[model samples]
Target chain A: MTFLSASLEQSPSTAEEEAYLYLQRGLRLCRYKPGDRLIPEEIAAEIGMSRMPVREAFRRLAAEGLVTLRPNRGCIVAGLTLDEIYETFEIRSVLEGLAVRLAVPKMDADAFLDLERLLDRMERAGQTGSSDWVVRHQEFHALIYTLSGRPNLIRKINALHVVIEPYMRFWFDYVDKPLSAREEHERLIRAFAQGDALHADQIMQEHILGTAPLLAEFASPVRR
Target chain B: MTFLSASLEQSPSTAEEEAYLYLQRGLRLCRYKPGDRLIPEEIAAEIGMSRMPVREAFRRLAAEGLVTLRPNRGCIVAGLTLDEIYETFEIRSVLEGLAVRLAVPKMDADAFLDLERLLDRMERAGQTGSSDWVVRHQEFHALIYTLSGRPNLIRKINALHVVIEPYMRFWFDYVDKPLSAREEHERLIRAFAQGDALHADQIMQEHILGTAPLLAEFASPVRR
Candidate 1:
C-alpha cells in the first residue's frame, strides 16, 4: 500500500534543520496534539540535539502557524477552532484550484502516469486502512501543484495544508466513510486526462470545499 | 490632497515590539535597501534600546520574510528577484479578489465612508507626490480586507503585502505615471458603492494583475 517508502531521503544539514524536521514531522503525523506545549530541553534530549537548535526550530514552527510562542510560556502547538478550519479550507480551495488550472495544460504523459500510480497506491492503502493512505493522498494533490511550476504558490498551499492537517486527521479518525476520497480523486484524474483545465479546477475546488461540512459535522456537539 | 492625519496611534508595548516596528517602518520606507545587513548593536543604539530586544526583533522580522537569517552572518533585508515579484502579485490578486467578494455583501454605509475618506487621502498624496500616499494607498486596500471579517484571510493578504511592499517602493520611485493608481481606486470605490461583488472582485483582480506589466517595466534593463 505504500507508494514510496515512508522515509524521507533528504538529510538535515545542521542541528537546527534536523530539529525543525523532527518537530515538523511530529506535528504532521499528529504525534503532538494541538495546544501541547513543546519543551525544548526534553525535545533536545529525545532528538539527541542541544536546546539551542530546538529553540530555533520553535521559532520557525511558530512562524509557520504550526505553533504559537507565548511571551513567557514556551511554544504550544496551535489548536484550530471550527471557524479557523473553515477559513483554512476556503483559502485552500482557491489556491489549489488555481494550481490545477495552471497545471492542466502543462501536464504530460509521464505526469499522468505518476498520478495514476499514486492513485492506485492510495486505493490500496484505503482498502488496507493503512496510515500511508493519508500520506499518498496528500502527495497526489501536491504533484498537481508541482506540475504548475509555481513554487511560491505551492509553498503557500502547503502552509495552509499544514494548518489543516490536524483537522483532517480528526476527520479520518471519526468519520464513517473513509473510501469517498478515492472516488473524488478519480474524477480529478479523469479531468486531468481529458485536459480540461476548467473542469479540473472545478473538481479540485469542490474536492477541497467538500471537506468543510464533514469537518463541521465532526466538530458538532453530537460528534463530541 | 491630504487624507487623514499620518500618525499611527497604537504605540509599541514592549522594547521588542518597538524595535520590530522601527525596523519594519524603516524597511517599508526604503530607509534600508534590499540585502542591507542589519547590525543589532547599531539599530539598538539608534533606537535607544538594548541589543537583546533588537536581536529578538530580527528573529520576528525573519519569520515575516522581511529579513533572511544567515548561519554565521547577521540578518539581511530580503531581496526580491523579478520572478518573486510576479509570483507575489499573482497570489495577491486572487486573495484580494476573494476578500473583496466577501466584504461586498458585508459592506455598510459607514464602511463606504471610511473607504472614501481613505481614498481622499490617497488622492491628495498622489497630487502632492507625498510619501504618505503609499501608506494611505495600502490602508485603503487593507480597509477592504478588514471589512471582509475573515481575520485569517486578512492575515494572509497582509503577509503577501509585506513581501511585495518593497517592490512597490521600486515602482513608485521609478515609474512616471503615479496618478494612475488614483484613477484605479476611483473605479474600485464606484464598484464598492454599487455593492457589486462580482464587479468589485473583477476590478480588484485586474487592478492587482495590471501592476505586473508596470512593475516588469520598472525592473527592465532599460530602466536600470
Candidate 2:
C-alpha cells in the first residue's frame, strides 16, 4: 500500500511490487522465520518472474528493516534481539498512545460505532479460533490509529507493527491460551467512548507494552 | 551514517552514494528548502556524475520521506504542514525521552564528561554565532541518545531531527534572538548527573516539545 508506494516507480502490476508484496505478506504471516535465507532464484521460479525483480524486492525489504543483505551471503530475514524487540514495543507504546490521543478529538459517533463493529467482528473471529482473528484484530487497531491524522507518525507505528506481527502470529499459533483480548478491547472502546484522551493513551500504551514480555517469554524458544 | 546504510548496495565511493550524501547534507544543512525541485540532470552536472545515479539517489531520498516524487513533475523537497511538523516534534519528544530513560542506567561518569564537553563546544559555537553550533548541538543530543543502546529508536529520532533541522537552521538564521539553550541543556546534564532517569526523560520530552511552537512561528513566513 502507501507504505512504500514512493519506491514503486511503475504501476502495481510491476514484477518488483508483486515480489515485494508476496514476501511482505509471507513475513507478516510468519511463513518466513528469522535468520532464514531468501533465495532470489527460488522465489523467482515460484512467482514465474526473473531473479532481477526478486533481488530488487530484497533490496527494498532490506531498506525497510525486514531483511538483511550480507555482503557475500545474500539476503537473510532480519532478526531482532530480545532487547531490541522490547525496545520496539516501547517505541510502539508511545507512538500508538499518541495516535489514540490525537484520534480522540477527531472521533465521531459513527467512528465509535465503526470501532465497535470491528471489535465485534474481531471477537467473533477469536471465538471461532479462526486465523481471521489476527487480521481483524490488526484492522481494529489500525482503524483507530488511522484517525490520528498524523500520517508520518502512523506510518512509523505501522512499520513497527509489521516487524512484530510474525511474533504475534507465532504466539497465537503456538501458545495454548484462548484469545482473551476482548476485555481489553472493550475497555479501550469505553475509554474512547468516554472521550478520555489521556486515559485512552495510557490504556493503549500499557496494552501494547504488556504484550512484549509475554511474547518474548513464549517466542524465545523458537526464535532462531 | 547508519540511517540508510542498508540502501547502499555498493561501496561509499559509488556515484549513487556520493549523490545521496551530497543531497542529504544539503537537506540537513538547510541549503535545500521545502518545495525545492531536485533536477537530476542539473545536480549531476554540478557533481560531475551522470544523471542516472542522481536519479537513483532521488529514489532513495523519496523512500526516506525527505522528498516526494510526482508522476511528471520529478522530485521535490518534502514540505510538511504546520500540524505535521508539530506532530513530528511530539513524536520526537516521546522517543528522545525514552532514549534518555534507557541511556541513564548505561551512562557513566565518562559519558557525562563527554556530554559536558560537547555542550561546551555547542555553547562556544553559539556564542560565536557559528553555524557549527547546530552540528554540535545535534551531536550533543545524539551522544546522549546513542548511549540508550537502541539503534532502531535512535535512528527513528535522528530521522525526525533531520526533517525539522532546516526549520531549526531557519529559526537561528532569520529570527532575532540570542542562542539561549545553554542554560536549558545545562539543566538536562544536571538531571543526568543526578542519575534521575524519570526527571531526565521528562526534561528531554519537554525540551523537544517546546521547540515546535517556536519553529512553527518563525518558519511559517518562509515556508512555501
Candidate 3:
C-alpha cells in the first residue's frame, strides 16, 4: 500500500467533497441508520442535488471507520458490541486519566478561568437539564488539551469521544436518573484549582466511568 | 454537533477518494513536506483521475489532523513541534504501559510463544536493518493487543501510529539505528514472560519514551 503523500498542496477541490461533509454530519446524527441501503441517487434526490456529492460523503465516512465498505456488500453503519463498548471505556479510562494528569500542571490562570466559566454554565444547564451543557462541557474539557500542551494526547482522547458520544448523550437524556454531571464537573474544577494531579485524575476517571453504571443495556451498548 | 451518529449510506466512488488515500499514504511516508499546497486539478491530472476524489481525500486528511483546512486559503501538512511530539509519546507511554500491565498477567504459554516468535523475527530484521522488519515489528507488538483485551485501546494506539508514522519512519530510515528497538522489545517480552507487570510496565515506559531522544529533532518542521 502507498504511504501518505504528505503533500497538502496537491489535493483537489470539488462540490462532492462539500456534499460528503453534509452527508457525514447527517449520518453521524442518525439521519442514516445502520444497515440502511443508501442509493447515491436517493440522497441526491432528497437533497435536490446530484448523486455525486452524496457518494463522496459515504466514502469519507467509510474512511473514518463509521461505515463499512464491502466491495460487493454496499455499506452499513459500524456497530459495536457490548464487549467493544466496555473495552472502549477501559481504554478511555486510561487515556482520560493521562489527559487529566497532563492538564493539571498546565492548568494556568486562563485555563482555570475558562474552566470556571464553563463549570458555572454547566451548573446552570444541569439544573435545567439542557443539551447545551453537554456541548459546552465537551469544549470545556477540550480546553485542557491547550493546557496539557499535547496535541497527540488530545487527539487520542478526542477520538474516544467520537466512539462513546451516542451512549453518553443517550444516558444523559433517557436514563431515568441521569448523572449530576454538573456536580462532577464542579468537583473536577476544584481538583484542578487545588493543582492535585492525582486527585484530579481520579475524579476525572470516576467522572467518566461513573456514566457506565447508568447506561441501559438496550439503549446503550457500552458496558461497565 | 453530532451526539453520535450511525446514518447515511451513499458513496460516490470517485478517483478523488483514491487519490486522497494515495496522498494520505504518501504523507505517512513523508513523501510531501509540511505546508505544501496541493492543486486539486493538477493532482487529479497527474494521478490520471478527476478532481473529485482528490478533494475527498484532502477532506479526510484534514479531519485526521494530518493537514489543516484553510477554507479557501488552502491546506498545509501538519508539523508537530518537539513539545507536541513529546506529549504524544508521554501519553502513549502511559497508555501503552497500562496496556502492557493489563496484558502481561493475561498472557498464557500460547501467547508467550507467539510473542517470542515475533521477537525472534525482530532480532533477525534488526540485524539486517531491513524496512520490512520495522513494519513487522509493529505487527509483533500488535499481537500483544490481543492480551490487552480491549479493542478500543488497541484502536487508539493504532490511531497514534497513524499520527506518528511519518516522524517515526523518517527517523529510523535516516538514523540507520534499529538496535535500541531490538533491545527494548527483548526486555519487554522477557518481563512479560517472567510475569512481572511492574517490570514489564517500566521497561515499556522507558522504551516508549526513549524514542524521543532519537527522533525529537526530526519531528519538527526544520530538520536538525
Which candidate leads in DockQ?
1
Q: Which ten residues in a row have the lowest lDDT in candidate 1 chain A?
A: A1-10
Cα interface RMSD of each candidate = 2.3, 2.6, 4.3
Q: What is the TM-score of each candidate against the true structure?
A: 0.83, 0.84, 0.76
Off by over 4 Å in 2: A1-13, A30-32, A37-56, A70-73, A124-130, A176-180, B1-13, B30-33, B36-55, B70-73, B120-129, B176-180
Docking class for candidate 1: acceptable
lDDT of each: 0.77, 0.78, 0.68
Q: Model 3 over residues A1-224: C-alpha lDDT tens digits?
A: 00111221243465555566555555545566555677777777876789766765766666566666665566566656677666667667767777888789877798789888877776666533456765666667767655776656666666556555555555656654445666777778888888999788778778766766555364453322
lDDT at A115 for candidate 1?
96
Error of 2 at B183 (Å): 4.2
In candidate 3, position A168 carries an lDDT of 57
lDDT of candidate 3 over B1-224, digit per residue (tens): 00011111233354654686567666776777677777788788988988776776776777666777676777678767777778778877877887888899899999898888877777766543467676666667777765878766665566566777778766766776745777788888889878999788778879889888677875554331
Ranking by TM-score: 2, 1, 3
Q: Give the least accurate 10-residue stretch of model 3 chain A, judged by summed lDDT.
A: A1-10
